[model samples]
Target: MSTDVVQIETRESRLEHLPISFFASVMGLSGLALAWQKGVHVLYIASEWVSLVIAAAAALVFLTLLGLYGAKVALHPSHVVGEYRHPVKLHFFPAVSISLLLLSILALNMWPAMAMPLFAVGASLHLVLMLLVLNSWFNHDHFQTVHLNPAWFIPAVGNVLVPLSGLALGYVELSWFFFAIGIMFWIVLFTIIINRVLFHNPLPERLAPTLFILIAPPAVGFLSYVRLAGNVDAAAHILYYFALFMTLFLITQVPRLMRAAFFLSWWAYSFPLAAVTIASLTMYEKISGTAFFVISAVLLGIVTTVVTALVVRTLVAIGRGRSACPNRPARDPGRLETQ
Candidate 1:
């Protein structure tokens, strides 16, 4: 190819790859961490501090990579996926990944000193992204049976909640402002989605179930905040658990949307990972007995194993254009990097 043609091709390729590359990388980090966290339980039974340390170290590295990517995205907005078009949603992976890395570092260093800021960053950015999503949908036509791209929402919410989970550790500050903003976001997002289903444009059967899938992560975040903030009152617990269960019920339909197992979206397929995480919370709250934590932990382990393997496989397949029932072939990998 001529050099000019090659340059044009490269630029086009960069635009195409921007969206999925960030998502795949972010999901890869979450999947691997869940796997390691679950695996460590077995090894730690033997008091394997060394193994635990190594596992934690690996997690730190993963978080660092995720954070670096986020920083790159923030510095070079052109690299933001789908930035060329509406600029509706500012993908939260970059911001959330940085928050996760910082939180992890604070935890490892025993730095109560740094925990509050990390926590605030996580909590605030999460609210910001949620608001953006809400505002976008509120103004746009979200119905019309639009073909949902699982890649977009999956990593978006997952990455945000990963750090938001730190709120559970009790090392962070709570702002009523943040929570209020979050509620507004929730209001807008749900309104638009409901409007689509009920009034405006109805999603087709094929695309309909994906709506349920999109609800998973944010639902998880709601549950995670309640769980992590620790000390839920009777009313609070009841509300949170009710929402949690409903979310899980929604997640059950994901496989149906994907149809053939071979045709599952990298995003839709990974819903199980988020589902597993949600399941853990459910078990944590539902069973109040001594065996409660253990049983839930086991479920989390199984879910983690299955989800992580699936994510890794998808990454490989997408990287090589070998996905079993590929919907969209991913762009060239090199175009993911921005100068």
Candidate 2:
């Protein structure tokens, strides 16, 4: 092939390999933004602007990914369909709607006008994605026990996130509907995931970081429940404490997580920690407990550190043209980064 023709194909190919899972970065960043927002109030931090800047960055990243993925859809329909069929990556697709939901929350206090539209669109889109995902799983031909991972928690857990903003948007009944679906799915999937972990082979390194996703459904569920229910009660305690327990459980795996190879999935760590941090801050706000304040402070600091590390590592990976980076190496144009 001519050099110009070869170069053109390589560029197009790079765009095609951009995975839908990159939206997890937006979820992580927006979670950090909300955590910082809560920290300022609960922890008496002076750095509220940190939240603004991170929220803006999250929005920017979301737009960029939207445009890029939109291009991939237009130029690479087959590749998109392949991802839609893939057992694992299929779940990550909902991250787009969830990111929108989170960005809606980030915009809530600062821009209520913007927040409403974002929430409306996010809520509507998430329902569609959730249905599609369920249908796929129910009718799938190729799924098996080994295909199960914590990432499967994304779609269901994402529903529990609605009330965090949906309540404020005056969608009281709708918010409850989403929350119920999310909780039911969470219970079902939580059992299946636990069973898989106990009886099946251990998750490979690439999927290990996804264990962090276990923290999000409960943490986000706690935050959403308090907003919807107007106070922390017995049920709230169950969600919050279970999430906290899961967080601690995962901490013991820190040594192994630290040793695992870098994957796009590492972004998995950011949002759950952020979820728990925001939950802690909320708990402190409601009860005036010094312990909740301390816990929130600790979690906020850890999530900030984790996000910073992820950003630096992502930049380095992109520069070196590694797996899952946007600037994928031309030599491997056909490789899907999400793998």
How many clashes does each candidate structure show, in the order listed? 3, 0
User: Candidate 1 at 219: error in angstroms?
Assistant: 5.2
Q: Candidate 2, after superposition: displacement of residue 224 in Å?
A: 0.9
Best by lDDT: 2
Error of 1 at 180 (Å): 3.6
lDDT of 1 by residue, 1-339 (tens): 899999776545533343423343334344334434433453243333433453354446446545554554665566554442232223334335333433453343344565556555655565555556556645755423333233235334434344343544543434334444444445455555565556645554323434544444444445445554455545445544554565566557656654522322333333334444544445455545655466456645554555556556545654654322112333432111211
Candidate 2 local lDDT, 217-312, one digit each (tens): 999899989998899999999999999999999999999888765778889999999999998898999988778878989998999999998888
Give the clash count for model 2. 0
Stretches of candidate 1 off by over 4 Å are 1-16, 24-28, 31-84, 87-175, 198-229, 251-255, 258-265, 268-287, 290-298, 321-339
CA lDDT scores, all candidates in order: 0.44, 0.88
Worst lDDT run of 10 residues, candidate 1, spans 330-339
Candidate 2 local lDDT, residue 167: 84
TM-score of each model, paired residue for residue:
0.58, 0.95
